[model samples]
Target: MVNATQVSFFTLSAYFDTGVFKYLYFIIIVSLYIVIICANLLLIVVICMNRSLHEPMYLFLVSLFVNELYGSTGLFPFLLVQILSDIHTVSAPFCFLQIYCVFAYAAIQFHNLSILSYDRYLAICYPLQYNTRMTSNKVSVLIALIWLFPFLAIAVLISLSVPLQLCGNIINTIYCDNYSIVKLACSDTRVNNIYGLIYTCLIVFGPLSLILYTYMKILKVCFSGSKQTRQKAVRTCTPHLASLINFSFGCLFQILQSRFDMSSVPMMLRNILSLYFLTCQPIFNPLMYGLQMSKIRSLCKSIIFGKTLTDA
Candidate 1:
C-alpha cells in the first residue's frame, strides 16, 4: 500500500484474462461507443434544431440525452483505449475524474427524473398552471439545478475522499466508482460510510418517492379523468416511465454487485452485470425517447429520408 501522496496509479481488478478475445472485445466496445454517440447526438440534434420541439418535456429530454452522452463518454473512451492496449492501469487523477463523472452521471439521473416527474405532474395534474409553472425560464433553471445539485453532492463525497490514505492500489471493479475508492482507504471511514448512505437515500428514495407519487396521481387522472387526458398522459408518461424502469434496473444491478460478493458468478456475467448501467442506459435512453415520442421520430425520419438535416 503506497501512501496517499506517493500513489499515482491504480490497477482495475475486472480486466480478466480474455486472451484471444482482446481484439474482439475492442471491436465490440468501439462499435457500441459509436452507436451510443450517433444515437444520442441524432436525437439531441433533432430537439435543438426544431423550435417546435422546444418545451419543458423536450428540454428535460435533451438534458437526459446529454446525461447519457456525458456518462457514456466517462467510460467508453478510456475503455476502448484499455481494450486496445496491454495496460489495465489508470492514473490517480484520471481515476478520480472518472469517479466524479460516473457518480455525478448516476446521481443526476435521479434528479432529472424527479424534475421530470414534477413537470409531468403539473402538465397533467394541473393543466392551467402547467404553462405558468413550466415556462422557459423555469425549465432552464430546473435544468441547471438538475446538473448542478448532483455535481455538488458528489463533489462533497469526492472531497472527503481525496485526503484518504489508501490501503490498496487495486480496484475490484472495471471502473472508478466512489465506493470502490472509499473501500480502499485505510482511514476510519465511518463518516464517509454514513454520509454515503444518507446521500444514497436522498438521491434514490427522494426521487423515487416523488416519481411514484406523481405517477400515481397521473394514473388516477387517467382512470377518472377524460379520455383526452388519459391519451395525453400515455403519450408523454410512457417514455419517462420506460426510462425510469431501465435506469432502476441498472441501479439495482449496481447496488447488488457492490454489496454482494459476486466472484462466484461467472466472470463474463459479472462484468456484464456490473457494466450494464454505464453502457446500456446510454444506448437505450436515446432510443426510448426518440422512437416513442412521435414528433422526434418524425423529425428523425425526415432528417434521414428527406435529407434536410443540413438545414437543421
Candidate 2:
C-alpha cells in the first residue's frame, strides 16, 4: 500500500529564474500596478467631485475601480516581494489567504461586470424606465450584493481547504492559485476540483452568457432607431464592449487553465502568461473605460491645471 510519503514529490523550478529578466519583470509589473492604482484612485475622486458624474452608471464605474484596486493589491504586492527576494516559499496560512483573496476578487469582478451589463441592458432596452428602475437605492443594494456574495462563497471554500494536508512548499505560478494549492494537498482533491469547476462555470460562464444576451438585445434596440441614433448607441457601447471582451476572454482562459492539467506546459511560459492576464486587465480597464472617456479626461486636466492657475 502506498502512503503519503510514497507519492512522488513535485518540484516547481522557477522559470525566468535569471537575474535580469526577473528584475525587468518586477519593475514593469510594479510600474503597471502603480499606474492602475493611481488611475483608479483618480477616477473615484473625479467622479465624486463632479456632480455631473453622479449617475448610476458612474457610481457603478467607481465601484468597479475600487474592486479592481483591492484585487490587484492583494496579489501583486506579494508577488513583487517574492520576485525581489531570495526566499520564494509561502507558508500554508499565507497560501490559503492568497487563494481566498484571488477568488474573492474574481467573483466580485464577475458580479460587478454583470451588474454593468444589466445596467446597459436596461438603459438600451427599457430606455424611459431605466431611471426609475436603476435608482440610487437599487444601485446601492446591487453593489452591496456584489461585494458580500463573494465573501460568503470564499469563506465556505477556504473552510473546506483548511483540513487538507499540504505536501509541498513551492507554488509554480508567481502568486498562489487554487489549482496549484490543491495540488499540494495529500488527500484526494477530486471534490475540491469538482466544486471549483462548478463554481467557475457559474461565476464565469453564467455572467458571460447574460452579458452577451443583454448586448444582443441592446443592439436590436439600437438598430430599431434612426441611423444616427444607432451610430451613437454603438459609439457609447464601444468602450464597454471592449472591456467586456477583454474581461470575458481573460476570465475564460483562467477558468480553462484552472480546470485542466498543466503539467505538460512549461512552467515559465505559464508564469509569463498568467502574469500578463492578471496584471494587464487592471491596467487596461481604466484606460479603456475611464481615461479614454471625454468627461474623465477633462476632469483630470482641470484638476491638474486648476491649482496652478489659481496660484498664478
lDDT per prediction? 0.86, 0.75
Off by over 4 Å in 2: 1-16, 261-267, 307-312
Q: List, residue by residue over 270-306, the lDDT tens digit for candidate 1.
A: 8888788888888888888888888899899987787
Tens digits of per-residue lDDT for model 2 on 1-312?
Answer: 223333333333454466778788788878988898998898888888888888887888888889888888888888788777765766656767877888888888888888888887887778789899999899999999889988887887777666666776565666667676576788787778787777767777777788888888888887787787676566557777777677667766665666687778877666666665567777777787765578777777777677421211
Off by over 4 Å in 1: 309-312
How many residue pairs clash per model?
A: 0, 0
Candidate with the greatest TM-score versus the true structure: 1
Best-performing candidate as measured by lDDT: 1
Superposed by TM-score, candidate 1 places the C-alpha of residue 34 at a distance from the truth, in angstroms, of: 0.9
Alpha-carbon TM-score of each model against the true structure:
0.95, 0.87
After superposition on all C-alphas, the RMSD of every candidate to the true structure, in Å, is: 1.8, 3.9
